[model samples]
Target: MERWLGLARSLVIYHNPATVRAWRRFYGQILRPGDLVIDVGAHVGTRTRAMRRAGARVVALEPQALFARYLRLTLPRDIVLIEAAAGGAETVARMAVSSRHPTVSSLQAAFVDAAPAAPGFGHVRWDRTEEVRMVTLDGLIARHGVPAYVKIDVEGFEIEVLSGLSRPVPMLSVEYLPGFASLTTRVIARLEELGPYRFNPVVGERSGFLWPDWRDGAAAREWLAGLPADAASGDLFARLP
Candidate 1:
């Protein structure tokens, strides 16, 4: 019974109109017609729906068994929902999802380590562990098709997912937690290897701050490598070179 309640709480927390509108703009403005989209950490299909609404083919990859099931039920009939996580070549990994605040789920413990000192971290309680199936980017692309726009929000595992992609999809948006981003420095460096990545906080989520960029890929990597220890949410957009 408590599990059901927790699930319901997640649904309501995510289905806010402000978040919906922000995503609608992102998909409408960035995604193109006939574009294939890979949604890593699709959660309950909010972005999946927004992508479909923007006229794109979507592959919703989720690691949590229960969340994946919820996505299947919520996403459109046309979207392909995959019951696996996009990560390193392995086929499974342990995912830690918070019990009190399931929204702060992460693939790395560093999130929990950093959050205690962060604002609003006091209310979160991580009380669950689930080993889920894992899939790689190359495998997913070969199975469905190439994605032009890929949205990744895998908590701390975003770096692993990026590495699995053998080829650069046109545009990629990934959520980077500053606390974890330092730990995943390779991810910062690799995105730069793709050339000229731009980062901005999600519009409407906060006041939306646009960050500085490096003159070249190398500089960008260095800048990120030097980031402070504060944990904040930001999305990175890299146009493949």
Candidate 2:
């Protein structure tokens, strides 16, 4: 299933890393050799490959059965590409399939609700629907190993995904709904719940970096809380305190 979906949604921006060049740079410090990477939404394994190239043992996690198949084919044999979603437990959830853009398809309504009013809205046509297993970070760690870094881009359900984590991920990243700052607030709180976190955004592909000279975590959150909803379309990188 992972293979078919990757071929179907290769055009989606989420699977294409070209637009997030700056984000890759900002996360440079966290990517290193032998480090374990828990890619929560390992759709197509694009980021999974990146982490591998950057020298990390990636545990690519995806719930969509089709996507999981692709991860197996595309990723190196060493990558423990798992077929399931990351929440809090191993269960099944109804997933929404994209007829237009399969990569953006997600089971969580919050993710679809946070979709931007842009070109990719109808991309995932929702042609098919299915149920996929869901698991948690601690569970993955127990099965594979505790990760040095974890990346979550679960759309609007980012909070629920984060809420499911039972282990401390030293360095992590998650998507933010600029349109729904309330969601962003919850994400920040969740990050803080794990430990100290700082906000840094990258604008316009690889135009440049934007790291405000904030005094502390509070200051950084204050700055992020003020950015316009359309100010950016990226993830918030954080670290454990």
Candidate 3:
């Protein structure tokens, strides 16, 4: 019962109408009808819902049991909800869970270590852990076919998630934190190996990009390094040329 309350709070915060609209506008620019999208770390499926509204076929992945149950109950029949984590390989990984604020739950211990000191994350606490199955992006591609776009928000494990992709898709985005800027650079380095991908930044949940034009990986890395240490977390949008 207590766990349900925490999950409800997360749903309320993330499924707010204005935020949903912002995500819709941003995602609409990238998704098209009949296109396939893989949403790793789908959480409560708010972004999955946004992508569905954009007319894309979505495969949503969530590792946490409680969150997975919430998604299974609310999501429509067409959306594919996978109750497992996405990583560089298939294995059982321990997930540190915050019962009161489930969105901060992560598979990376280092992320948990660094979060309390980071602004906006001081209230989060990982009170417990659960072992969950993990799957690779390439494995998902093999089973579900390659996606047109992949949205990954696996906390500090973004690099591991990207490691699974043997080839680049049309477009993809990974969550980035200024507190963990170096990890974002590692993610960029991984993406560079996959394709000649250009990048842009979308801070927080904003509908607009930071730059008027996409820049190269080196430029993007430099921009990330230049950001203030307190800059809010956001996603790095990358696309293959």
Using TM-score as the measure, the top candidate is 3
TM-score per candidate, chains pooled: 0.83, 0.81, 0.96
lDDT of 1 by residue, 1-241 (tens): 5456667787887766666666767677777878999988887677777788778898888777777778777777899988888887857778777755666777767776677776556677778787888889889888888888888887767778877876767777777656555644566577766555644444224423355431444544565566664645566556654
Task: Give Cα-based local distance difference scores for all models.
Answer: 0.71, 0.68, 0.89
Query: Which residues of candidate 1, in runs, are more than 4 Å off?
Result: 181-185, 194-232
**Backbone clash numbers for all candidates listed:** 1, 19, 0
lDDT (10s digit) by residue, model 2, range 81-170 = 778887756788887767456656676776665564633453444567778888877777788877888888775667777777855677
Arrange candidates by TM-score, highest first: which order? 3, 1, 2
Compose the digit string of candidate 3's lDDT tens values, residues 2-114.
57888899888887777777787778887889899999999988789888888899999999999999899989999999999988889999999888988878988888999
What ranking of all candidate models by lDDT puts the best one first?
A: 3, 1, 2
Prediction RMSDs, each to the true structure = 3.1, 3.7, 1.2
Residue 135 deviation, candidate 1, in Å?
0.3
